[model samples]
Target chain A: MSDNVVPMKRTGEATPSLSPILSLTATAMNSVNQVILDRMQSEIPLIPALAGHLISGGGKRMRPMLTLAGAQVVGYQGTRHHKLAAAVEFIHTATLLHDDVVDGSETRRGKSAANIVFGNPATVLVGDFLFSRAFELMVEDGSLKVLKILSSASAVIAQGEVDQLTAQRRIETSEERYLDIVGAKTAALFAAASRIAAVVAEREDAAERALDDYGRNLGIAFQLVDDAIDYDTGTADMGKDRGDDFREGKMTLPVILAYARGDEEERRFWQDAIAGFRIDDADFAHAVALIRRHDCISATRERARHFAQRACDALSIFPDGAARRAMVEAAQFAVSRGY
Target chain B: MSDNVVPMKRTGEATPSLSPILSLTATAMNSVNQVILDRMQSEIPLIPALAGHLISGGGKRMRPMLTLAGAQVVGYQGTRHHKLAAAVEFIHTATLLHDDVVDGSETRRGKSAANIVFGNPATVLVGDFLFSRAFELMVEDGSLKVLKILSSASAVIAQGEVDQLTAQRRIETSEERYLDIVGAKTAALFAAASRIAAVVAEREDAAERALDDYGRNLGIAFQLVDDAIDYDTGTADMGKDRGDDFREGKMTLPVILAYARGDEEERRFWQDAIAGFRIDDADFAHAVALIRRHDCISATRERARHFAQRACDALSIFPDGAARRAMVEAAQFAVSRGY
Candidate 1:
């Protein structure tokens, strides 16, 4: 880690933690959790069956927590954010279901993916159900502005997914393109999830934009660390398989940076590996070695630190309080999470 | 055909036609088509490429036509329905793309399905893009009422689809249950698309309810005819493969009726076929033969005629004129389509 990186805390010896966030939003999150459980049920038994499989699994519920935390940061006292927070979680869950199907994932959150357990058809339909349910929750809130933000973010996410699919297996993908995909597919929802809190709080535009910035930067930093961990063989498995990105030919930041920094011989190996010619465990080991040789994993983490620092900075507008501090620590935790 | 069935028209010399509805909505449909083409585009090339493969395919834009025709029936002068109509079409297209993937179908609208032309990953992602885009369109129109109707309908449709999946391969499925599935998955969208026009028109509650009934019954009738056609060997291939329902073990109305009316030996045969133990062409032929002997195709179409007549009657509250006649005829056509 670099000295320029943001510290986990200004006064404590502890590492950055989500404990403050979890505690800060714990009571409100119960209401949000109730909304999620209530809305996910349907007369169609399979809809709830498939949705509950993933939702009841040990997901972090990070997106909805952002909504709740964002509300506290803005000093909003209303209960409106509870339902809205649940909507955010529903959207995130829907995205995960589709993502697992798209990636053909076997395990998620230390268990079989919904697609694996229910089969792809049921998984996809339940995802659609949850997505539509998200919109229903928003419409119940009756905020046109919130609807616009979330619906637009949803479109951007799909575009990013398609763009990433296009870039898959293409060895020549640039860091810029990878970052753009991360911004859309991951950060857009995070941004929306945080921003909606400001809207419900009746906060000024400045506060809204600040929350958006906080979530977006934190999301990018989070994704960068995730991509780094895929190649970090030293780390324990984090829910998903370690080399999923490698086997799927995802042009993640570490892969992009490694290819950029490689010699002619190393470049040849990357081309073969990224083009789906190399996917064995030995190939993954070699890929990780190449990434480590170029110090790309640390490089990726360094970039994550920059974003995490910005995420903390974006909270400066709010008064120095536990809520803002918790969010800031959460952002730091996002980057330093695996390592 | 039964003696009590609804005739093609009040007068002889022509079968019921979509021509009236088509011509009535023709000019406004151009605008909807433009919106669909423009909005479906993305920086990700594969999105529009995959979407267009299905969009530009020669399928009739039936649902959007409902919106436009409903607008005409209610004398809605504003052009807002144009965008809403496109939104309906986008939802329908998204469903079709997912349906093809779920069914593992090889063709749609007589061309290769988007899933077949593009891979399933791209197809599913493009479907997501279109669905999100549909919401974006609705949000842009800034009508919470319209959003509520469509979003609620979407949730119901997903529930219905999951229900149908649950019903698949279970030969004991009842006609009442099948009808319920059709009402949710097919008729709900129809109801929403037509009702939104009245909402945008700022019409009375009665008018809105009338439009909903018109659309819902019409949708049910449309689905009944489609299900009947799958068993109709005398019918020309209607863009989809004949006996797909049989092979997929879907217990449509024809199968339900044939099974109910069947003797012990025939019941055993259906049990084997619907359980996927029999899937060859000869098995499908036997299934169709049993259906024909039991006169179940006509029975299914007879149910379609009842719904179509109800659909036509729902429009009776509107003034007697071209729009009303066209809608009525469209309902008639829905029931008689595959015959």
Candidate 2:
């Protein structure tokens, strides 16, 4: 490990921020964004139109930033990761497009979902176009290693999605199973995205594993926080239609925790609501009250905080500087969203 | 070209059949089936369950058979094409799953479609899993050439699907546009599957291009005959729900031909039907009558015969032998399916 100083958050600082990582990756992201825009185009007008709707949407580009930052942390000077990073974003966007269709989502990133604007058939097909384009990009890069990572992660994501569908209105879904789904559907891509950075930089296996662990834990934290914000009612910057999970009868962590701790009466209410019996505004209000009473949101964020810290700690083996500090702070910022 | 004899169809013999190709590819296809069964397995039970619904639904494994037969034509002795053939089938199966979802298909291969049995969410996600698995298999094969062919074909297939969707309700969809969509969505994969056989054999580019032409023409004939069968009252062994294109407003060649040949009153009926107004059994029956009056189904089959002949001619450069004869017979069988 290098003998450079690792920056820590100031004692009693106002809040953790994402600016460090944002500025650190700003220049690199422009190249990645160009690749993304160029690659998403196709002869079919609908392919580019629907893909652009989501690509231009205000996503954080958080996953690719991990790749860029991890590259910086390893002192790599090559520009190949720009295309790789764009491929990562394409994979992510493809999943999001499919997710909206599966969920019958009304809005995404605070706008009408692609499925809504373009219809599900076009949406699904465009998602496929983007996915195939992702592989094409990886093939052009000629990295069997990256192809394996991304392809395996993609399968895991789809499997996780199916698993989540199986667990969807069951009401008996365990936190373990929920976490498994989170790891597969959400964190698998995260881990792959971060791990590819080390591979592109030609770093050691230890560095790759370190970045994988960091990304996986950070992804879990990020998903947990998103789940928390869904029911928090205090978060006004909702990027999707609120109460969508509740209406769709998704067995997320908040519901799982609340149900695990509910009394017989409260349990009956949850059982009814989760079984698709109660879904009006009043029912959602009651569900929110039950969750807040059990402090499940806080418990969920507490879990997120644990993973975010683990993400930061994963960076310690690398040289400490702006790159390391930015990545560490980005982890903190991931958990701080919707606060 | 070797001095081997190319078998021509015997005059005064029985109709051309798929038996030659079936016998030619039977052994190798068993190995390909093994790979497909092995790879389609996943930790998520729903994936295999849903995927198996379509895989075992008794549809002929026509695309992979093309790969195996093309390998024989090229005299490839290796077992690598088995995995690659399975990869081709996986891509085909993935697209079928997504197509059923997109078209809201109720029956596939004369049984309940996967979406009908397993729900759309699982169907879509499993399709994604299988698609990723296809890429994984190709990556394991470690041929960048094969990857490029398959990936580019996949992108074209997706684009074709989107193009077809855009043309769905437009009664003015011309024969040219319909052919373009069919080429991309169906023939592209067929071409890729056949070409990969030459790629793995390390054959000359001439052999690859010839095989590609063979597959592409056969695929067009296959799909054209399928569209013809949908409207032909004389045909019995329909694979999917009849009139699905009619009900869903898909602009296939049959519809385009009938519309093009219709009178003013007939044209209005066609327009209304294509625009989703006329969809009852009576309307479908009347539509069939009008199509028959125009001899659209026969015209469509004439078109198919032209392509099938081209498919057979494309294989002429190869030595005429059992492999060549089997593939040529397979093309004839493809166009003769619903007769």
Candidate 3:
């Protein structure tokens, strides 16, 4: 997995060597991740019988790591960090369950999805269960601010999903519309999960705003990179098949940009392959080749890097700490994985 | 619709006279039902074009009416009642969207269901959108109590759905479990809506408890009548095809109770029909007839009446206002529909 990727050096960067910070962040994130898994197991009994197979099937756990790292950057040592981490994971899981059902996806992470195994009804209801359980856990935290933030994020995510459905296969979707969907459906939760840590830690207004901005930028960069990976990565390395978004007719940024730049013939190809119901391997190959020819992939990667840079800049207000250093490093890693 | 049903009299018995209270309640309910339909129309622009057709196809808007009647019973003059009514309606619509997907139901209200029309993905996401919209509206009321009640009810309803999935096709399911599922999934929201009035009015604790009990019992009775109607009514009146529950191997209360009292041969028939995966119209007819032979329908109807009576008893704690009287009559109407 690391063969094609060259790790960037930090010589000219604002941050110094991140080796120690990255190591510590990794340890803290793993601990919090374990706590999340444990809490999910305890709360959802059916998780072991049905969901456990998927939970252990191998996921990046990137969202939960971001949450834990966010709490760490704010110097949060309280046990509630565990709850926040679990909340983030639950939100992530809920989205995945609904996504599989929405996309009619059969396999995920190289294994049959919950919908495929337990059937769509169980998957949908279990997803609802996870969402409700997340709320219950948040309520137990007894923070009105946290509740408000999480609830609002939940709404935004749902609205974004609906927006995606409405905009699917629509070649006319603007970059602004695409960003809005990604921001709401993906980045919003990431941003909220991180920003919530400052609120929980009772940080000052300046500190809170900085972390919030950092989280928002990092989330955008993270999603952009994820979208790029869906196009760039291999099926085995990605733990699932590539071209899934294209197969589902989702109008991601690369497709939108490529379709916008395409000539009459290219546009016709897109219409036939995506909108006009002609989806075969040849269509997928043409779509991918067209995207590459338009340099949309590189353009998208550059955009992701811009957000990553902004994320690092947002953390400048933080005191010199290992967690802050790791935050910057993680943003870089998001972009690096795409190359 | 009202021809054979005996109207309730002042002496708590059936009478030939047309009940003015019932007429008034129906009038008020119809007014609120119109409000619900109008509000659903306002949200059409935010949803897919197909959603409008699916939603407006032919929903009965029964739950919204219950919310309106609940609020009116307390003489709630505030316009917030309409918002709450819409919220309840949104929740009901959301549940229906998910239910259609879960059951793979193609037709609802005599037209295509949202899932069938827009596909499962759109239906599920739109359901999420509706639920989020409901929460947003509830939040606007600026009542934390209402938010808490509604959110909790949503969680319970979600749990009940999961419980039903886990228990599906299990012929050994107990009567107690059946009530639990129905109470949580169906009655909880009704109970929450009615009890919310007392919370909003800042009424006495006893009054709140009474309204809550009234709503809960009313909901149970309402669902029992609905279950009975599934077996008794024709496709035209019911709006959707019937006998799917038995075909799908769902063990409703009547089936569970009938199975418990059946002879060995009769038990074998049910086993083959439900557990042995053999279901046809003949099997469905036989199951219904068996339930009838065991007087399960009448027994269930009596249970429903008991709940309705309990709901009426709860209302006795309130003053004898027209609204209260209407609520009492409405409860009677709920159970007496089949007779």
Model 3 lDDT per residue over B159-253, tens place:
77877776778888888888888898899988887887777776777867888898899899988877776666332465646676787777787
Question: Compared with the true structure, what per-residue lDDT tens digits does model 2 show for residues B1-339?
Answer: 344333335568678898999999999999999999999998888888888889987778999999999999999999999999999999999999999999998899888899999988888899999999999999999999999999999999999999999999899999999999999999999999999999999999999999999999999999998888888877776665678789889888888999899999999999999999999999999989999999999899889988888888889889878999899888878777778
**Model 3, span A1-339: residue lDDT tens:** 223232233566644233544575576666666755665552325544455666677776666666667777778777676676677777778778888888888898888888888888878877775676676666567666776777777778887887887888887878898888888888888777777888888888776677767777878887787777667643236565778888777788888888889999998887766684767777777888888889888888888888888878777766656677677777787777635
lDDT of 1 by residue, B1-339 (tens): 433243346655588778998999999999999999999888888888898898998788989999999999999999999999999999999888888888899889988888878888888888888889999999999999999999999999988999999999999999999999999999999999999989999999999999999999999999999999998999887896898899999989999999999999999999999999999999999999999999999999999999988887778778877888788889988987877
Clashing pairs in 1: none
- Candidate 1 lDDT tens digits, A129-163: 89999999999999999999999999998888989
- Ranking the candidates on DockQ from highest down gives 2, 1, 3
- State residue A121's C-alpha deviation in candidate 2, in Å: 1.1
Clashing pairs in model 2, backbone N/Cα/C closer than 3 A: B5-B320, B6-B320
Better of 1 and 2 by lDDT: 1
Error (Å) of candidate 1 at residue B79 is: 0.4
Model 2 / residue B106 / CA error / Å: 0.6
Quote the positional error of residue B251 for candidate 2 in Å. 1.5
Chain B TM-score against the true chain B, candidate 1: 0.97
- Per-candidate DockQ values are 0.82, 0.88, 0.39
